[model samples]
Target chain A: MGDISKKDRIITAALKLFSENGYHKTTVSQIANQAEVAKGTVYWYFDSKKELFQAIILTGIQRLASKIENRIKEEDDIIEKIKLIVMIYLEFFDKGRQYFRMFQEGMLAVIDDNFKNKLMDFRTKQAEFIAKIIEQGKKEEKIRLDVDSKDMAYLLLTMLTSFNSHLHYDNDFNIISKKDTIINIFLQGISR
Target chain B: MGDISKKDRIITAALKLFSENGYHKTTVSQIANQAEVAKGTVYWYFDSKKELFQAIILTGIQRLASKIENRIKEEDDIIEKIKLIVMIYLEFFDKGRQYFRMFQEGMLAVIDDNFKNKLMDFRTKQAEFIAKIIEQGKKEEKIRLDVDSKDMAYLLLTMLTSFNSHLHYDNDFNIISKKDTIINIFLQGISR
Candidate 1:
């Protein structure tokens, strides 16, 4: 029980430090101090600083994917699934804003080939997941038949991501309203 | 004439290097070498590497703003103006892909107070520009009167930026079709 809690604490500490100082500027000792764990204890869970960074990123993506997938599995209505997905997305990023910032930085950085491959796979999976939802909508006749599910999926993902990004840049933005507005805009064009 | 040409070359080289290696990894001497100018010449035109970076970003923004504004002025029809604006935006970024990549990096990086203020001002100007178009549409009764012009402007801007970003990540994306599709989706939406 203690081992599990110690590992979780180390991860939480590393995430905050990495976000504040960036991957290159942050160090293991700082993470240890922040976590209030012995330096050697970090090594027990992760091999090195690089591995820990990778773990933080990989874990974030995987956790988000699984959470969305599990919740979506319990839903049958296409529109409801989309609304739920958007809510989950906004909530996840809202809670882990720092982690998302780090993720964006990691994307631009020239990382190792293994990490690059993993990132690519994650993006593909995300797009595919959205596409599946659009496909389901089409089957239910909830979406326009002429619409390409893949294109619409991409567009929806873009809308959600961009709206979330704006929230980070502008603090005064009303989150709940923004989420609803995004969904409304997606469903109905700004037409009379 | 020679001095002006040298300055142009220096800016061009610096833009490419900075895009490839990021701001910190790049150096003034490397920029000079790439530009085929002496190190002193780079210092002559720009006080520091930081200034050069600001110049690259500011130039890109100003040029885009001017181009969109001028073309918008040429058209009285709101729909036509929107189409032309989208075309020009895609063309500008497609031509200067490297510069766009660098701009995104700069936004994420920690910068000086002056630069941050300028960035904020630039964003306001951009949103205002878009809002102006939407307001015109509303007056022309081409758009829904109930829609908040400011929110719609932000949404349109988000769609354009996100679509352009996806182009960078996915090389197989068809640019012209994507542009048309984004405009279509914005105007009509994907609902049946």
Candidate 2:
């Protein structure tokens, strides 16, 4: 994890800067200073700010995907797998709220559009991977046969992406703040 | 439609400048020059750049929300209304993509957290309004009764926020990109 350690350090600094100053406003020098690494070291890990941010975006998404992948791999049943996916998703997000913050708010929006396109492509594959798993569940007849794998995959992703991960806000709505209850309502419906 | 005309012109100019030059880089004078409106006229319509951005965010959300509201308003069926909301949301995003593109990226991260706080509050109210509508649908027994109103509201809002109007991304093939398709997948689920 030597390279990973250095990469992670850079990412941590990048996150703070991005959140505090916006992605574009933050500079390589700032990240280098924060990382306590020399400018060349920063470039050694990431050649440019855009490339560094690309690393961050990919790292964030892949980290979540890896965690989910492992959790799903442990479960054999399709129903159990999906439920686990949802649960683990909220659980991991709860823990990695900063990553979620950056990911959701477009920390890399200042990066080139081509890079954004690549991130979306990465996301697409991740969704397809989930859809395929759901498809397997469908074949087992474990999930609803009529269910659309692709749509479910997309909905799950967008929903997951939308979760702000912060518990408190300017408002006082204790009713809408809990995660377990929120997940329950999502899987089912609120009406009678 | 003079007001509409003026508003449209301002929005158009703002969209291009904000997207390309960013919030700070793009100034009111720049906007006025581009819109071809007198600097005083720009100031008359908007007090300052901050107000202009607030206007941009508010107007964008209002435009999208109004479209969704109109589409779902006629439907008494909660499920149908939900579907329509999804559909109209996708279409609205398609129309306002440029506006969203402008504010959606690195700029929001740079803006004062207070501004975002207000915007997030606005989003909550918007979601609550939809939730109330769904709640009514539940009472009328036209919608499912299992999902929590708050969670459902959050779910819909998240989808809209994260999905860029729920329009299909080329990367996401698991779900239908169109409005009606997502609504169907959402209401019925993939389960046969």
Candidate 3:
């Protein structure tokens, strides 16, 4: 807590309060108190609560993008790279379910047009990241050449997104342990 | 429209208005006007707008379940049955995007506990239906035996659900032509 910057502290506190009490009910004063900063300090970093909430979402998306980029760069085999992509998604959601919930709220809640546009932009960028991986897989001859990389990327992403919805209903279902099994099904069709 | 029952008329108008203007913005009188029925007549059928909204959701779910049940029975091949399930899902969403939006809104919006529990029940029943199909596929050697039927069902359902989200982002993406492509990717996966 001592090492964390005031900006980081505010953002962290905002995410917790927003997720727990929801966006409208959560106040900047509450965020300031949680972050151990003065009410005015929250404004020092963000102009408004809406801006702070948007920052929380953008930060999480950027963090995910960087993690996927770095992890996939560490792998060479196309199939292995794809598996890594799937595993990263599961791990991200499984570990950051709260942040994921925040993101969903940000998307669904009545946010400003600018915030809505940013959310949509993040979705497009995420799909593009996966599309790039599928493109690489196709070039390596590991994935089918017949399928459109973009569509396949969307499909893969859709599967992962659906996994989030599934987890919402069955929280007890262990996604972490099913990681390999999930990847296996994605990698090699479920057919014998 | 004339042949439709009063209850059906009320539900239909409510669904459209709710999907378009949102739940809170939509009023009972507006629904009554749209249905060409008296304001009191609307309440004669549904106790509240919430009840009417729940009825719309339940009707959609029941219709989908029955469609899947009847369609699967006509197909003997387990794989075909599963494919039929996928096609039916896409068709349902495509034809009923408004209703789907209502369902999503119902899910994201703050609703009564009864509505929330009903939504959860519909989701569980959906996964169970898909699981039954996967179990049959395994028995016929159409699908792999190593994977858990429930997990696989959830996975397939996840893929379709993702498709809906994808549609939200890229409305131009033609899911109909990509049906085989998507089903192919799901059944055989994207691997070469």
Candidate 4:
């Protein structure tokens, strides 16, 4: 019981199973065997499969949120802050490929309604953060004020969602690229 | 027997089965029974289930494409052309609610690889059509050529996908209702 780190062990096992069989088919016993932990041990850390799955999503979102918060905390300018978001979001999925897979597949037709609600709430926060950026840019005369920030934020989020296809199947279909194409497009789009 | 209409019989049965259960679950027997036709009669026109589904998608896509084509056909300016596309796309989805449901629940994930490829190709044509509008806009000095036409088309598509959530959910979900608000944001962005 005291021999191993439970949480890390659980996440590692869950990731493998989720990647292989998808979230729906994989069960606690399989994860327990892979983690080399007892069945009770897995349940102790995660009450159910849905909780474990939610944990994965929450961890990914929180990680992204914290990273974004830390990056923007250093900058006072709105434009610079927005730049960090574009780069960080792309990088986060790049680094956490499994999370990206889970994010896309689970986000589409996942079982948990509450988790989806949480996701929608997180999306609101992300949009709010973008709106604030647009507001600041407007105040500084770098952005147009006539247009609403909320809608624009939704636009950016959609672009980000499609951007996942780039990571998943870059050669077959891409949402962004190594040419810094998206970054340039955003800058050209907003440059006053 | 002669009074049984062909178009109404096939589609009415299809929409019922596809919506009630799903595309994959509903079989040809049920469809033929509902249509008051033999299985061979259903096969005579459709060839197979995949072909039938393709026929359904074709019906939707053609209807949308022709309407956009006709609306923009009279306009000389590219700005007017793009506006027509946006208007047509949103209006069609609004009015054609059943087709929209079929479209949103696209059989990309559940179908055979060959069938999925055909569907994806059809989608690519849509993106190409959008890119052509942007390309024409560039020639007309309406949009910048520096940004890739395909990418910009994708941008508009992405925005539409995100905004669709607002339509389905009762909550505004932070997206504004005003079309001009959205159009202005797309046209001018946050930048002054």
Task: Write out the backbone clash pairs for model 4.
Answer: A144-B190
Q: Would candidate 3 be rated incorrect, acceptable, medium or high by CAPRI criteria?
A: acceptable
lDDT string for model 1 (A41-120, tens) is: 99999988878888888998899989999999999888888889889987886777667666555455545778867867
RMSD of each: 3.3, 4.8, 4.0, 5.0
**iRMSD for every model:** 3.3, 5.3, 3.6, 5.3
Of 3 and 4, the candidate ranking higher by lDDT: 3
True-vs-predicted CA distance for residue A42, candidate 2, Å = 3.1
lDDT tens per residue, model 3, A48-109: 77788878877887888899889888998877877888888888988877666555444444
How would the docking of model 1 be graded? Answer: acceptable
Fnat (0 to 1) per candidate: 0.27, 0.19, 0.40, 0.05
Q: What TM-score is obtained by chain A of candidate 1?
A: 0.83
Tens digit of lDDT per residue, candidate 4, span A1-192?
A: 676587789888998887555554577899998998998988899888768877887877888988887888898887777777888887776666556655444433443577768777887888898888887788898876656677667666655654553343222444435325565556545546
DockQ, Cα level, model 1: 0.39
Off by over 4 Å in 4: A1-7, A19-21, A24-47, A94-101, A107-113, A162-171, A178-192, B2-67, B92-112, B158-171, B174-178, B189-192
Worst 10 residues of 2 chain A by lDDT: A166-175
Compared with the true structure, what per-residue lDDT tens digits does model 1 show for residues B1-192? 446599999999998998886665677889999999999999999997878899888888888889888888888788888778778887886777666666555555545678777766876788888888878787777777766778777666655654555445555555666677667766664222
Candidate 2, B86-127: lDDT as tens digits: 766666666655555555453444456777677777778787
Query: Which has the better lDDT: candidate 1, or candidate 4?
Result: 1
Q: The CA-based lDDT of model 3 is what?
A: 0.74
What does the lDDT read for residue A106 in candidate 1? 45
Who wins the TM-score comparison? Answer: 1
> For each candidate, what TM-score against the reference?
0.86, 0.77, 0.81, 0.72
